[model samples]
Every structure is written in structure tokens, then in C-alpha cells.
Target: MSDDQDQEQDQDRPAAPGPGELSPEMKRSNVRFALTLPLFFMIMFPLCYITALHLPVPHDLPVAVVGAGAAAFIASAAPALAGKFTLVPVDTPQQATDMIFQQTVKAAYVTAPPGQSAHMLVAGADGRVMTQLVPTVFAPFAAQAGNTVQTVDVAPLAPGDGNGIGLMFFMLIVCIVGFMTANILGNAAYFLPMRTRVAISAGVAVLTPIVLFLFMGAWLQILQGTVGQIVAVIALGAVTSFTVGLATTALVAFLGKWALFPGMLVFVFLNIPSSNSAYPAEIVPPFFGWLSEWHLGAGFVDAVRAVLYLDGAGLGGHLLVIGLWFLAAVLLVGAAAWRKRAAAAGEADAGDEDGEGDEAGPAGAAASGAGPERVLLGRVHDHHGTPLPGAVVTLVDHRGTQTGRTSTTDEGGFRIDDLPTGAYTLIEAAPGHEPAARATVVDHHGGGGHGGRVGDIRLVAHEEEHRHRAAVATDGTVPPSAGSYGGS
Candidate 1:
């Protein structure tokens, strides 16, 4: 047979495996991924729950003290109750009542003159645990003055939500639904553009909260608030859902299938424990208390409590936290979309330079095995020579346009294949480090299968760079230039 005929026959045969056939590496990766969930749940559930929930010790719980001699009583009691309670002395019972309604104090202790029982004003809306804990802690203190404590629920929970924790559970439900919807969209409808995905997420956020509100409020009667307050709570829920959905979707787009780990880590592990839902932040460990200050779940729960029970006191601060998270999520999704577009544009521009057009595609002649593959290989490392995995390497052409990009693997290795032979500037960047750049040339006659190795590229930490510059400035000497490189 003629050589041309033989070549044509060989080309007719499939060069790659069938669509249903999974590579051995892919199979192993899938198995490992499936096994990771139970392990993650086991570790995170205990770590987050136990550390935050188990043996909660209230630290500096604010309790307003009212009536005459309140200041003197607190002064005497302050030493023994050093870390447990912060006694805020108020002139009258009205001030203490106002503080409880405003959520400035968890509860208030009103001392009677002598024989009459002292009243303990507690907000059931602060959760059943706080209501019970306040009286228990203060009863002995009241007894020392020859007076018994009488507990009063100044701001009680809704009749249907006897425990007062239903709002927090509601917030958790909304958040889970929000993020899960993003997961579905990421996996099932990934072809949708970023704008479309965001719109769909927004729609889900708005609708899901309304549906949940109907079930948790209208039907169940668990929620208690005016029409405006109810609307505000619903808005907070929508914001929570929208922010979480967008953030999770962005993570999926950026991290691919492995996004679940970080997604759960942020939304579930850190968020739920720090939410101050089951227990207030003052009662929990300090780590969770810190998280509660800014976490999404905490913001949602706090906002709901303010709207429903606290007469909107401190609502703005809680909303601000949620707003910041929303802004961050929007920025993340925008950045991911921009990166995707830039990558596609780079590939298209590279294809145009190769004169490949649509038919030849991004792979160009290399796809048809018509020419040797022009590839670049490199490893990224820290100044200490430790491999910097997940570092991004970008190749820019002479025209200052990005042509290729790839991330370093577990071993800090990266490869950009099927490139056109040309001069390029390779930039390696990792978080917390200053980006390193070097010039290199890829040629048809390059080493090993027409590809070139850029070797090890090291990045210095930003602090090190700053310190070096400062030291040079202090010495009255010019800082050394960032190193230069020539074509390989």
C-alpha cells in the first residue's frame, strides 16, 4: 500500500479512549474524593461542635444592675465575679428594661429594698439558655443580700418557638439551601455564563426565603414581628442566601470539584459554630466569639434577632457584616469570570497568531500531530527551596499579552503544552509572596520533544522584600534590583 493510504487508514482509528472509559488516575481520584466526605464530616463536626459547644463558660456577660445601692453591690461583687459578669449599674428599673429590650445587656438584676423579692429582667428572645443561665448565676448573689430572685421574661419568644432558637435554625436552613443550590448549578449547569448563574442564584435567594418564611412564619407561627420587621428578617435571609450561593459558586469555578472542602469549611464548620445560635458568643470559647463578630451565619442570626425582638437595635452593624460578605462574594465571582475570559482570549489570540482559525482550534497543528509540540515546563518554590504548590504561572508574549497560564501541582510542577515557538516572559505568583518573572524563549529545536524547561523559579515573601527595601533605605544605599534573567 502507498504511504499516503497507510497514513489515512491509521488516522481513521480512534487515538484516545472512549467517552465512557475513565483513566486509572481519574478512577482513583474519584474514589479518594468519595471517601473524603465522611472523613471530613467526622473531623469537622467534632472539632467545631465540641470546641464551641462543650462546657461553655460565659466570659463577661453583661447584666444591668438597677435600684439604689446597685453600684455598691456591684463594687463588692466585682472581685469574686471577675470574668463571668460585667455589672452595668443603672439608676432605675426603666433603664435596665430599656437595656434588655435594646440587647445591650443579656439580662438585668433589680434589687428590692429588703423583704420584697428582687426582680431579674431577662429576654427570652436572647434564647432559652441565656434566660435560664442568668437567674441561676444571680440567684446566689441575690440570696447574699437576704433577697430571692424573681425571673421576668421582658422580651419573650414567639408562642410557637418556645425555645427561641427557631430563628437560628431557620438561618441555617436558608444558608444550606443557598450553598447547595450553587453546588447544583455548578455541577449540573456549569455551561451557564457567570451572569446567568448569578441571576439564577439571586432568584433562588429571593424565592427560597419567601417560601421558608411562609412555612416558618405564616403557617408555623414561629416568627413574631411587625410587618416591617418580618420583611427585614426576610431580607436578611435573602442576603445570606445570595451571598453564600455566589461565594460557593465562585469557589466551585475557581477550585473545581474539590471546592466542597473549602465551601463546607467556611459555611458549615466555621460559620455554624460561630453563629451564636445554639449559644451566645459570650458563653462560648473565645475562638468562636471572634468568629461571631464577622461570620455570615452570625450576622444573619443577629440581624434576625434585632428585627424580630430587639426593635431593630444594633441591626445596622449586623447588616454591615452581611453586606461586607456579599460584597466579597461579588468580587470573587467577578474575578473568577474575568480570569476565565482572559484565559479564553489568550488562547484565541494565540490561535490567531498561528493562523489556525476555528478549524485548527487552540491546539492548532499540534492536535493533528503535524508538528512537534512546543511546551514549557517549570517548578515554583519559596526562597527556602520548599515547593510552592498552587502557585500560578502565567506566560506573556512579547506584545505584553498573556498567552498561557497554569497552576503548580502537588510537587510544584506546571506545564503549558502546544505553544507556538516564541519569546515569552514567565511570571510565577503565590499568595503572600512577591511574584517572580523571568524571560525565556521556546524554539522548535529546544530540548526534549521540542519543549523547554524553565527550571526552578523562587519567590520571596512580601515581608522579606519589604524588610530588604527598608534595610537598604536605612543604610543610605540603593536597594539591589530584582534579579534579571535571559532567554533559555
Candidate 2:
């Protein structure tokens, strides 16, 4: 390096920073960012209303009615069902479903030629849910009439779809969400200050999946689906994690760590329960029913349920919601990163101005301005020097804009950034390990405060066997054979 360049660099700074080291001005400019908080309600309300709330049952939905008695006799109950569901009544035995290919009726019920037991002919072309509806609705009528409704499938489901396609589709999306969250959080922990963002990100990261997973399983027993549903939840965990990670990073890029709360409320509290996976939202409480609008879980679940149950009548709206979220998040995150670069350049320019002024000699300038606040950021690792992945990091100030936040780190380390000079409760995320949030006092007021350095902030990932045991004891069982983070 030339002496001239070296002198110019030293002249610009009160102190020289080592390679990869961050300066106060640099932190101030790059650390803070802002962007649009999606108008979730506005985006999803219309679709939720049209398909979920509105849509009258499609009419003459080719329902094959197979039973005994005459035209009015077998159909004594048809008028009642038709009042609600548009049912196509196939009159005779042989001619009942001759036009099945004509798409006239979806199912056919043929009386067993006078003395023969009644038989059913169902079209295999329809969705699993739509196909099942025929049998489910017809059984009660046969029971009331003292006649058995014997069903014969003219068509059956494809083997691959035995578990139902919609269920698998939802599982795939959940997997996408999980990986997306992991990568997003990992990026923030790397780009921002590692120490603070780690625990907070990890905290929100892990809990988000756990919360969504447990709800879909415990609150709604949709987890008990056929062979297909058995491990479907595991995939959902992946989806939930990745999708949340994307939102988290996008939010953090713009809003910083506080983005975790809104992310969860957007994906979890709003999406999962109201998804109407177990029952139609009409059956659930009205307030809780709107989950389909604001929550991704609910939105995907609705889309999957439609593909599986609604015969594809209502998928358009929910698909639109997911598409918008993913696209918008990608753009916002890109913009936020761009802004950081711009801000960093601005700070660098400000430093150059200072050097020029100093060389020109001190003018009789008496004006005073506060210098940038120093932010403390560091990585948290175990004593073993391994990345304490999935750790939570938190940051708060006196005003409490950060009143509630808990985030987790990705497979790397932790970071906490954008903090003004203040005392902070720096917490780490260890599921069962309850480590008190260590405290730190930043000193950006360099000339008047302690020293040039911001402050000392260090944390170690705690190993708590007792807590793990307690968690198992309280739950009366251990986690699956999967690793601690709920995996195989």
C-alpha cells in the first residue's frame, strides 16, 4: 500500500478499524431500514369471501343415486338434498350412467333390476373430496328408509392420489417455508451483528414451526390422514420454517429484528387454525375463521383442501395470496439490501469530508452535532467453537418498540444490530436451556463516555440436560427420534 493512501485513510478516522471491522458511521447508515408492511387483510379478504364464504354448492354435480322404490320413492329425499346440493338424479338402472362420459352426471345409482340390491356408479374423474361427498350424503337417506345403500364404484381414485393430492401439495409448500426461514435468518445473522440477532431469530425461528406443527396436529387432527398424512407434517415443518425465514429476513432487512412478531401473526395465529382443515370455517368461531386471509398456513391449507375437497372450485384466490407474499418479500428484501449499500456509501463519504476539512486546517467553526451512535454486534458460539445454530437473540430500548421479540440463528452464529447507545437485555435462544439475557451498555458518546469501543457482549449456548429431561417429563414423552430440532 502507498503511504499516501495509508495517510489519507488514517486521516479520515480518529481510530483505525481492522479488516472486517465495522465503524460507528458505517453501522448507523447500513443497520436501520424500513419498508411496507403488507396489507394482508386487503390482499386476501376478497378471495376468502368469494370462495370460502360465498360459493353456493355447484348444481347437478352429477351425483349417482342408487337405491330402491319408484321415481318419487327413491328420490323422496332427493328434493331435500337438491334444495342445498345440486344433485343430478339418474332414473333407471342400465341407462342410469350410460351418459357418464357425456359429463351429464358425476355419479349414478342404479336399482338392482327390481329384485336386485341397489348399486352405485361413481365417476372416478372427480376429486377425492367431491367423490366422497356422494357416499357420505347418501348413506343417511338409505338408513332412514330401512334400505341399505350399497355403493359400487364405476371409477376409483388413482393409486398415487390414495393419500389425496391436496394434502401432499400443502406438505410441499410447508417444506418450502421451512427452508426459506432458515436461509433468511442465516443471512441476517451473517450480515447484521451476530450476537443480538441470533437468539431472537432462533427463538422465533424454532417456535414458529413448533407452534404451526402442533396446531395442525393437536388442535386439528388432520395429521391422522392415511398413509400419505403420516409423515406429511414433517414436510410441513420444512415449509413453515423456510417460508417464515423468508418473511423474517425480508422484514429484518426493512424493519430489523422486530419483524419476527408480525411474521408469526401473519403465518401462524392467522393461518393455521382458521384454515378450516378439520372443519369448514362456518363451523368455527367467526373471529377465528378469518385466519384464511392473513395466515399462509391457512391459505395453503385452504388451497390444498380445495384441490382435495372443493373439486378445484376455490383454489384461485388462495393461490394468489401465496404468490403475492413470496414475490413481494423477494423484492422488499432486495431493496433493503440495496439501501444498506447506499447508506454505507453515504457514511464513507461523510468520513472523507471530515479528512478534507482537517487537512484544510480548522476553520473557526463553532457549530456542534451529535456523532453517530455505536452499535455492538458479535457472534455467539459454544465453547467448542461450533456455531450454536437455532439460538435466539433479542434487542430492546427504553421506549419498548422492541417490547416483544425472540429470533433464532441459522446453522451459523448470532447477530444483534442497529441499536442506539443504551443498556440492553441480550437473550439467547435455547429451547429448554433458560439462560438469563446477559446485559450490555453501549457507549456511542465516545469523547464523553467510557471509551472508543462500543461495549463487551458475549454469550455461550447453555447445555441443560435437566431441562430436556423436564420437558420430556412434563410432556410425558420424548421428542421423536429426529434430532433435537424435531427431525430424523
Candidate 3:
């Protein structure tokens, strides 16, 4: 049979192996992927949530007691309370008030002169969960002096936000949005260029806080902070969420679909429970307490509490933690992209050596049964250096008449055999990737088929339009002006 007849016969048949012809390695991989989903979702996910919210008790909470006489009485009568509280005794009520604003104390009790009622001051903005715990633990001590105990709220919750638990809800919302953004961006990485993807994700992350701040401060009147402080805290949160999303997407792109489990385990399972919103780290298990010191979720809550209620005290450490998270995520994603490029370069080098040995001389090529007709050969790759299989390649002559057509193989390679010796426009098109056209001349006498080889054709993606629309929805314009706040 002629070469044309043989080529036609091969094109009519299946190119890849059917399911029954699967290799043992492929079968094991499929089974492992199936099992991983159930293990992470069904077992680990619920277990983490239940363990964190079930039971919580104050372990080493901080509170201030005014007056030396009251401090001595508490040391003698409530020794347990002294151990649970990092107690700070001050001479006057003003000093105790300073401690609450500094976040050195969660609540404070002022001792009455003698035979009078005691006064308790608590910061309700420290989240309702812990705010309630502080009074519940100290109510007994307040009753020792007199029957009447005056409970005063130093920092109260927003009028609209009935309880301070709304802080926890906002934290959860930030995390969910972050992970969802990462999932969408990660899928886009397969088609879009790396720099474009990074710019889109990071830009959106930086802008998200502005809109959230406007809603929380200007519109909702929930956050009791100056415009600058509110913007700072919310920006930190949005950047932290952006980093988490970027890191998760990078892991999945580099390591495959199974890599999602590790991201979920760290960012969701561990982060949410240890955030110190639902359960204070001081009152929870040591494992979660350790995570609270560094996790992004905890950082957002801590910074928000410090800015809104604690007079901006102890916010530096929380902001540092969030900055570190963003820096580390950027490094990880960059490393993955670098590694992928290096691997593709290595493979291309090996292919070049083989192609060089095959192309000798046209006279010698004819002796070895190579025809006079020149052939075109090339490979298609995405922006990330990933092979794109089943991509269509069409050849058109100078007049735009269709000359030949072929599809990329399972290895992302294609060769159109027995082509006429002439100039043609080679168009490489693939799903998700941008279609590219290049002009090339094919001649059998040119370098004995060595110079005719098209090394690698890279394709861009059509993801920018989708990303732009989404960004507009989240951050279309600047937020409204914030209102002034008064301290109690």
C-alpha cells in the first residue's frame, strides 16, 4: 500500500488503548484517588469541627483586679481563679481600664471601698463567646463583697450585630471566599499564563478588603474603628485569604488533584477550629492553641479584635503572621512553576538529540528509503509547559486553500507526512488554549529534513475575560465613607 493509504487506514482506528487494556499502575492510581476523597471528606472534616465546638473551658484567661485589698482577698478565697487568670493587680480603676484597652486583660473588676457593690468591666467586642465566659467565671468573686454587682460594658457589640459572634461569621466568610477563589484560579492556571493568573488573583485579594470595610464600617456600622484601622485589618484578612487560595491552586497544579487534600487539611480543617473565634485558644486543647498562634484565620480575628475593641494593641504580631503566610505562598507557587519549566526543557533537549541523529544528508536519506516529499513535525504545549493532547493542526497554502490536517498524539506531537514542497501557514488550535498561526516553508533539500522541524508551539488561554468579570463583581468601585466612633 502507498504511504497515503497507510496514513488513511491508521487515522480511522483508535489511537489510545481502551479501558480493558489499562496498565496495572494506572489501575492502582485510579483506586487510590477514589479512596482519598472519602477519607478526607467523610472522616477528617466532621471530626475536626465536632472536636473544636463541643466543650470549651477557660484555662489561662487574663483579667485585672483593682486595689491591693481585693487582690489579697481573691488570692485567699479564689486561688483557682488566680491560676486561671493571668491576674494583674492595680492601685486605681484607671490603671485597670488601661489594661483592658491594651488587651492585657479581657475583663476587669474594680473593688468597692468596703461594704459596697463591686463593678465589672468587660469588652463585648472581644467576641460574645469569650465575653460571656469572662463574666460567667468571675461572677462568684464579684458577689463576695456585696449582694449587688454592677456589670458595665466597656466595648459593646454593633447595634445591628446583636452578638459579637458576628466576628466569627465574618472570619468564616473570608476563608470560604478565599478557598473558592483558589479553586477557580487553579483551574485557570491550566490555560492562562502564570504571570496573568498571579496578577489577577493578587489584585482581587488586595481590593476585597476595601469593599468589605465599607460594608462593615460605613454601611453596617458594625466595626468600631477609625477608617484607617478598619481598612488595615480588613486588608490583612483579604491578603491572607488570597495567599491561601494561591498556595492551594499551585499545589494542585504541581502535584495533581490529590494535592487538594493537604490544602483542605491545613487551611480548613485546622485553621477554622483554631481561629479563636468559636473557641478561645487559651480554653481549647493544646494542639489547636499552637495553631492559633500562626494560622491565617486566627490572625484575621486577632487583628480585627485588636483594632475594633482593644485600641490597636498587640496587632503587630498578628499582622506579621499574615504577611509571612502571603510571602510563603508566593514562594511556593513560584517554585512549582520553575520546576515545571525545567522538566519540559530537559525533555525537549532529549527529543532534539534524537531528531538530530535521524537527519543526515538528502542523498543518504534517499538511500535509506526516505521519499523526496518534505514532512512537517511539531509539539503543542500550554503556557505552563504541560502537553496538550488531541489538539488539531491545520495547514493552509498561500491562497488560503486547505492543504492538510492532523491531530496531536497522546504525547502532544504531530507529523504530517508526504507534504508538497512549498510554503504553508501552520495553525495550532486546542480547547481552552489560544489558537496560533505561523508561516513556515517545507523543502526536502533544506538541511536533509533537519531545518524543517518546528520545535514547540506554546499556546495562551482565554481566561482573562472571565477573571475580569469576576473581579468587577467583587470590587467594582471604592467603598462609602466611614463614620466616627466614640470609646465608652
True-structure RMSD, every candidate: 17.0, 19.3, 16.3
Clashing pairs in 1: none
**Model 2 backbone overlap count:** 51
Give the distance in Å from residue 24's predicted Cα in candidate 3 to where it truly belongs: 9.8
lDDT of 2 by residue, 240-328 (tens): 44455555665555544445445545554445335544333433345555554655666566554444333444567766766676566
Rank by TM-score (best first):
1, 3, 2
lDDT of 2 at 288: 50
lDDT of every predicted structure (CA atoms): 0.70, 0.43, 0.62
Q: Is candidate 1 or candidate 3 better by TM-score?
A: 1
Model 1 TM-score (2 dp):
0.70
Off by over 4 Å in 3: 1-35, 210-220, 356-488
For residues 395-457, what per-residue lDDT tens digits would candidate 1 score against the true structure?
998899999998987666676876766667777778887776655555322111112444455
* TM-scores for every predicted model: 0.70, 0.37, 0.67
Judging by TM-score against the true structure, name the best candidate.
1
Stretches off by above 4 angstroms in model 1 are 1-15, 353-488
Compared to the true structure, candidate 3 yields what TM-score?
0.67
lDDT, candidate 3, 1-488, per-residue tens:
55456446546633322212332344566688799788778887667877766787666677777775666656744676755677767778877777777767777877776567777787777666777777776667666655355778887777756666656766776766676566565543333445556677677776666666667667887655666777777777677768877787677556555566787788778877788764777777778888998988898888887777677778898889888888888888887666645543433343334223322222222222211234555666664446678889898887999888988766666667656655677787788766766555443221112223444555655652211100000000111111111111
